[model samples]
Target: MEDRKDSELKTFCSRNILIILGFSSIMAVIALIAVGLTQNKPLPENVKYGIVLDAGSSHTSLYIYKWPAEKENDTGVVHQIEECKVKGPGISQYAQKLNDIGTYLTECMERARQVIPESKHEETPVYLGATAGMRLLSIENEQLADRVLTMVTESLSRYHFDFQGARIISGQEEGAYGWITINYLLGKFTQKLTWLYLKPNGGDVQETYGALDLGGASTQITFVPQDKHIESPNNALHFRLYGKDYSVYTHSFLCYGKDQALRQKLAKDIQAFSAYYYVMNFLNFTSEEPPSQEKMIDTMEKFCSRPWEQMKIYFGDVKEKYLREYCFSGAYILSLLLSGYHFTADSWKNIHFMGKIQGSNVGWTLGYMLNLTNMIPAEEPLSKPLSHSTYVFLMVLFSLILVTAVIIGLFIFHKPSYFWKDMV
Candidate 1:
């Protein structure tokens, strides 16, 4: 009778112990899940702002850029948030009326004041960079260029933001920065080469695209050439980006921009063709599938042969001054690319005329801002192997799995002897 009583007591205790263990395992899993969820909550983002004024030959434009303060060193972190084109011609054109510089820049500066948060105003740095137009003016009259830049600097100083200086950037600087902008926007700088190694003639890694920038007063071409040896050291630029070194070939042709080339064509007494036809509209030149060199010449020839009166009727909306210049601009662009730059018929397909990339205008301004701010570090920043959320999720998943295994083992151990025998 004592043996029976002891056996009952032992069985009751064993069952109660299994129940306690199972309950504890479930509670542990719940606690782990709650802790993980609480720990994985996102933190607030800290952002920074910058401003660049591209005082181009034809016009002046203001660009506001922003990035996460923590990720400033990362490639492509900075991006244009706002673009305000300053009213009136290029700041260089304001040489005669230097006093009006401040007033002229007011509208755009006001727009900037409205766009950026007031708290960030004092911290945001503002910069102005004049391109070829000012460069030409400076060449003709150095004192006058200096005066113009002085006025521009003074004008920007009135704003609430931190004013960086204003100056005319060299053509070489222009070309190199343009190359950096495109490559950065395209994500070429930080691209991984793991999958590219398997392909034959893939050249061990991804190659960067060449930059062809055409503006009103100058044009620039920059690229990484297959041959490392550059004959013209003057045209060579070296950069260390994302821990990789690059030897880039870049050249800027002053007075070769579309507008300047058109003037040159007119000065040479090139015959003015039919009036009022927008060349892009008539030739379909700006389409996704651009026309071949031969197709372009053939189309231009047929279009230019038409009488002025007939062309006017077809394109009444276009102004007479611009209509007369279209043919020459088109032909000049072709000549500049083929003769001036030495691009071949086969290689012409590689050239891409892009106005913007990834919502930001492709230009030297962003690169210039990046350089001055030291936003892009020489060495890459360190990062965690796994994101916080991922780590937390994995921990929870594994804990649940462990708890399940323990429960299963406890259940089997507590089973009756007959349960195992039936399975066998």
Candidate 2:
């Protein structure tokens, strides 16, 4: 009777164990199928586009960016789809002939119309942001700058695209946007850039990086300084990205740009060189007082007309003494970074000059588009839905765990009946 009872108890436990194992296996298989189905589903055909015309000091470039409609709110989703270079100096150079500025953008704007899908033209926002060149032009001759802007705006308005605006962006905006562009390209803003837009009151951010940009007419330095106390009020910029707040220091030296600085230096050098010649002429004749200031000015003007104008006269026939002011330009850049920004020797090495980040050019244009279109979401999207490979890995991991747990439970509960069974 005792032997029979023991056998019955073993049979009951064995049956229950088999049922549990079968159920777990079925559930695992079902879960895997569900995951597979979800993973294989076709992605939606919902793409949105935008166009940005970067009117920098040296040149102009048109960038067309696209992102999935569903992912518009996510950060770093907007990517450069196509970039077209405008075949001339930046629009600011056309300040004198403002009408010509409108005509010059014809080819590039037409290219944009062709590149973006016909359907997207009406919805797609087109923005033109002029950099240092326009900024200087505005400061020097506000009327001319306004006329140039009007010309470009009128030209862009004719296009099918939603012409947003054409104007000279502030130096602070340029620096901040460039910083955002780099960090976005580098995948630093994984979740949300900051809670800036959503919260009207204020908030903080996740992480940020420094950005250093060098352009023909201006240089910008921007970074979230560790120390909160900023000496210069103009240099300090306050931003709230995603939900995080950041205090960044940014400075743009007007005449310190590579091209302008080089021009200024060349002008000074020519004046000095011409003085040497004048002194020789004076010594050869009689020791009279040097020529008047006006004459000296006239001599300097002969050498310092535009660099190109000077090049035509001096370096037209021979290319021997071209780019002589490079040394002065380099020195000016160093001084701007060191003495102007108060960058120490140790920290100077950390500064990075980025023309491009990843595949896209590191400029303010991308960030500008992202901001206007609300690409950087206030809330984090579901952590990039797990990849197919990740799903497979996780499924296998759980299956193994289930099997191991079942086996351990069975062994713990059901002891071997005989010595021979245990040995087997």
Per-model TM-score versus the true fold: 0.72, 0.61
**Candidate of highest TM-score:** 1
**Candidate 1, superposed: residue stretches over 4 Å from native:** 1-40, 72-76, 192-205, 264-283, 373-424
**Cα distance off (Å), candidate 2, residue 273:** 34
Q: Which lDDT values do the candidates have, in the order given?
A: 0.71, 0.66
**Candidate 2 local lDDT, 33-70, one digit each (tens):** 77777766775456778898888876788899986565
Model 2 local distance difference test score:
0.66
What is the lDDT for 182 in model 2?
A: 75
Question: CA lDDT of 55 in candidate 1?
Answer: 84
Q: Write down the worst ten-residue block by lDDT for model 1.
A: 268-277
For candidate 2, give the lDDT of residue 276.
17
Candidate 1 lDDT (Cα, 0 to 1): 0.71
RMSD, candidate 2, Å: 13.8
